[model samples]
Target: MVSVAMDAVGERLVSRVERLRALEQALLKAGDRGVRPAELAQRLGVRRQTIYRDLQALADTDVPVWNPARGRWAVRQEQYVGTVRLSIHEAVALFFAARLLARMADEHNPHAISALEKLALRFPEPVREQAMRAAPLLERRPRNREFVQALECLTLGWIERRKVRVLYRSARGRQRHPYVLHPYFLEPTAPGMAVYVLAYEESYFRQFVTLKLERMSQATLLDERFPERDFDPVAALQSAWGIMWSSSPVTVRLRFSPTVSRRVRESQWHLSQQMEEKPDGSCILTLRIGHTLEVLPWIRSWGRDCEVLEPPELRSQLAEEYEAAARLYRTAATADSVSGLRPSSGRHPRL
Candidate 1:
């Protein structure tokens, strides 16, 4: 098994508990060579007495801290959190993220639970309590043997830089299709949504696709290895509204009514977003994103206050949906009953 290390990326926000955790990591890395209290105090910007007291505290907790000689303290441990440190704010953020992972996991995944459990030890107090709770909370989820095996295969393939053969079942159909893919990233969608893998298929052409884990029935880590690409998943997904990535992006234009215009103007939803205010109090929001599929749900959430203005295909699609719903409402009104809404027997009305 490979030991994977993860660290937060952000500015430091100091806390006593955080400092103690950082100190533990320092000694863990220092190993038998050890470190002097004065050096640790200097590095941590604290007094030598503070470092001495902290070392005592570590020993009190049965941390296996010992000194070979005067002022030289070292920690003995098999597993070391090399360079592990967390800003107070980062700890809180990670607490929420671990909570998200637990809530969104469909299967009882031991790997995810292990990660949460290990991460829980780094935080202090209330945040630690919440993060620790996630392990058991996620453990109680339904167990799917196929899904668990598939995930393990994908994880190995990704870490080893090997191709993965997956039997992917599409959402629209019952049939499962085979694909030999280079697993680039294992990405979880928004809160309460399924997890997906951004993989590249190099069969006939260079094609990258997002395959949902729930849709994968089986996965096998292939013997053939693939060379690592000099790719940054964050940058590759920059233009994506969600997980769909593309070299060429399409422009999406949305106009919001005056009622929700202020709400839209108040928040910056995406980095690629630009707004245009009209004299009539309405506003147009233009964005460049990979696909319209991911943005459709967001636009629909705003109801009639949001209008799909550009990319005629998208506008037409929205028009068709709204018109279909309007017909159902008319049918309900005619029936004069709560459950009276009849399915549209007519073709979608024109916008």
Candidate 2:
């Protein structure tokens, strides 16, 4: 009868709604690794054509679903409406990460602040209270306004894929130079972050140049767009020891005494590092990296406890630096003696 037909129609509508919800949830879970049509169809217990139609329906409803790569479909993160479920450990981890980012990020950067706010809003009341209590314990440094402005300008350029002309101060000669740059990405550094760009100079075609945000005097976005070349940030920094990327890769070996062996062995210092423990409670750490300039100070921090086992050039450099330091100290001691000042006493003896 007509009544039976109505009941059947209502059931079908309910089933359709359930299916759509399932599809959306699946796409959200897929994340960066997108789902395939066939995979989705199998998972949803539907035909491939049916899944395709559902995807088109979702798109029509303003859901941001697209093929990130050929044959793979994913829901864009921004369009996901599901709550981000985080366990206590994950929440705490994110809280610390946000705190660190807030400290290092420019004060004027709204995105970082907004993200932290959103994350805080997501926590349960108890966790939220805990986070509020912990907030005061974190030490946040004041933002550098000049650096913030430069960062914002460069970020805009990067997002638009536009070229930027900048007046940059060189770290080596302390000279300012004008250059046109294709803003690529911002890389995080020790104390803060560093911005790397593809620079186009009159003498150079396209060179990878690292610029400190504070060092840039001006950044003017240009209308000219650059082609998105195949550049991998990881590959570019594979051999680099910290940020000094000019030199060729060299295998460096250092022997650390027993006093510092445990400290050295506990942490992974470099990606290319290999450690060997000796019977005498000492250890040898080997690294294949580029440019030893940045790492020289780190090596020197270990002082007499660390010995350069390979790469005679590095050994010689360290020896020269140590000798210079020793001479300076000796000269200071001689000056104090000539001034009629006892080496151990607090005051100079009266003539």
Candidate 3:
């Protein structure tokens, strides 16, 4: 009885393998004119009649297989040059990305919406309508219009292998830089709302400049070639929480209050963030970054609820910024009282 069961399993396995081979061959000969059943049977070492049965089984699933003229099989052009058979996971990811793009109508990227449109076109009518409906419900915060456009233009220049002349205004004032830089990527930052450009400034001895998008004034794309540099932007960015240090990547540790901990856990602030639960239900957030500036403001934003458990530079910097801000408020209050400025009772100043 056991021997008979084993024989049955072996036959099923062989049948499965034969069907897989036929499917693979159909895909391989997709653009080609046709494939013969006799040839397919010989390739799979199966009987010609078995090959015919397998073709029928494949056809039942709506795979576009055709027997042209005399028992020669062909994968139809619609199934060949047409729709991509993506796994459910891949389809969902595409759907998610498409949804994000459709909502970013404010973004000047022509390709963004176009790409989403192409993905929507791939789906059936009902799925397409569902995606379209979900798009309006997906809310994205408005980005700085000028900044977004400039970044998009720079990205185009990068793709076309062109240089850009930028009139950048730092904290001081405007400075012109006619540099050939390989544009890597951009990162979003908070408080006064800044977007930073991570690019290799070739004219400046191949130095990496993290320029604030808000500071860029006049940007012109130039027809200049950049000598390729042996640098990895991703690895460089790995040690950063913000646009600060680039010297060496180091481990950073922080303790968050229960409130802040809950908030931080729900969001991914850094690439290398790891959280540990404390005994008192608080959270210890550890991150590996190259710069101190990244975590400084984030810690300060938590007020006295967050503490830097490691990295002295970051802790001190946060302390100084907090002190500076406190002093500014103190001075403002004192001056207001001295000038007999009437305090607006109902209206609080929006921070």
- Looking at model 1, residue 293 earns an lDDT score of 88
Which candidate number would show the highest lDDT if scored against the true structure?
Answer: 1
Worst 10 residues of 2 by lDDT: 195-204
lDDT of 2 by residue, 1-351 (tens): 999999999999999889998998899888756999999999999999999999998887777899998899998764445546887778778988877765554434555665676677668898776655534332243556666566766776676667777787866757777777777776655533444443433224456676776678667777787777677656767776776554468889999999999999999998889999999999999998877776887899899999998799999989998999999989999999999977875677898
Worst 10 residues of 3 by lDDT: 135-144
lDDT of 3 by residue, 65-88 (tens): 786657567766434333378865
Each candidate structure's TM-score, on Cα atoms with residue i matched to residue i, is 0.67, 0.65, 0.54
**Residue 211's lDDT in candidate 1:** 81
Q: At residue 333, what lDDT does model 1 achieve?
A: 75
How many clashes does the backbone of model 3 have?
2
Residue runs of model 3 more than 4 Å from their true location after superposition: 1-88, 95-107, 122-127, 133-153, 184-196, 212-223, 242-245, 258-269, 274-276, 320-351
Alpha-carbon local distance difference test for all models: 0.81, 0.76, 0.68
Rank by TM-score (best first): 1, 2, 3
**Backbone clash count, each prediction separately:** 0, 0, 2
Candidate 1 stretches with Cα past 4 Å from truth are: 1-83, 202-206, 229-232, 337-351
